[model samples]
Target: MDAQLIAFTGVSAGLVAMPGADFTVVVRNALVSRRAGIACALGIGAGLLVHVALAVVGITAVLAAVPALFRALQVVGGVYVLYLGVQTLRQPHSPVGNPQGGPTARPLRQGFVTNALNPKVSVTFVSVLPQFVPAGAPALPRTLLLALIMVAVALVWFQVVALLVDRLGRWLRRPRVARGVTAVTGAALTVFGSALLAGPLRALLRAL
Candidate 1:
């Protein structure tokens, strides 16, 4: 059990650290304000909990079983991310400001929706959690424990990112650099959305 827990933690750490929509969103919010970044992280943690619950209840498996529904979800999620990227790219960049450390509901909601809508996230939880469930053990408690560990690790990593980016708040305040950061993140988001769409888009085209 200990070995499985350690292995799950290590694998989850690697997954959490990978550059993705979550990382890009955090960096973007962090550059805006430390509070915003932290809010985004908390929201993502909340979203992770949702995924974990769904996986534990076997809802994720049901979603996966319905191919059309799953594909539709992927398409919607992909298009939404792509839209965000395009909007970010088009928006005029501004200096990082001292946004009042309160009223950060938007960023929080943004983080939650982004993670929650992602079919891949659902798939990952469904696939990964089963691998570590110990033989002869009650699956429910073990799965929940693993999920909690993943969320804990993710929260720590995201908070670190938020703090680090906030520390560089000054440099990011520069108009040019700030714009550059936005552009890079925007491109990254676009790429992520495109990757999600590739197979589905290809299939759709063939069916046309």
Candidate 2:
């Protein structure tokens, strides 16, 4: 990749890695166990792997080629983000959000899946990975390398978010604070949805 593209990807990844729901999930796991935190980090990285892999194989290209498929995905993604916004408005339980898996191998698995299945993530992976890759780069290894870079960026930033928040999680969980937190999170989700909805406007701008 060119230097500009690399820089763009770095900045974009940094923006995405900013303190948000992904950070919260990793922080939750870390407060539970350091190992779990690392595992969860890897899992979140793995979810990006899926996105990068799909981009390498031209999956999003096919989707983008078909207007219907692409628009349908955008609609679905927008609706899902709206749903997440609503869900975030609910009261968060204590650290043990779910006790059913209390004795499982590690909480990393579910945490990872939560991110992996997240519609916003799917939309992002399909959207952003292809941009930095350029048109003529070697497919597999280059894509994998970019994926690793994205993951590395995510791991460093988010693990720090986890570590820093661990010190504050107790205080942040207070009833009023948590509600405020959730409300802000909901607004962020709405912004993501709006961004996805506005994506088509990019095509019009390019056409002009």
Q: Name the top lDDT candidate.
A: 1
Global local distance difference test of model 1? 0.85
Choose the strongest candidate by TM-score: 1
- Candidate 1, 45-153: lDDT as tens digits: 8888888988889999998898777888788878877877887788747555664455689779877877877888888888998899988999999988988999999
Worst 10 residues of 1 by lDDT: 92-101
Stretches of candidate 2 off by over 4 Å are: 1-9, 12-15, 18-43, 92-139, 194-208
lDDT of 1 at 39: 93
Residue-by-residue lDDT tens digits, candidate 2, 75-191:
665555555555554534334232122333444564455455444554565566556666687657665666667767886776666566545656655667655665665677666
In candidate 2, list every pair of residues with a backbone clash. none
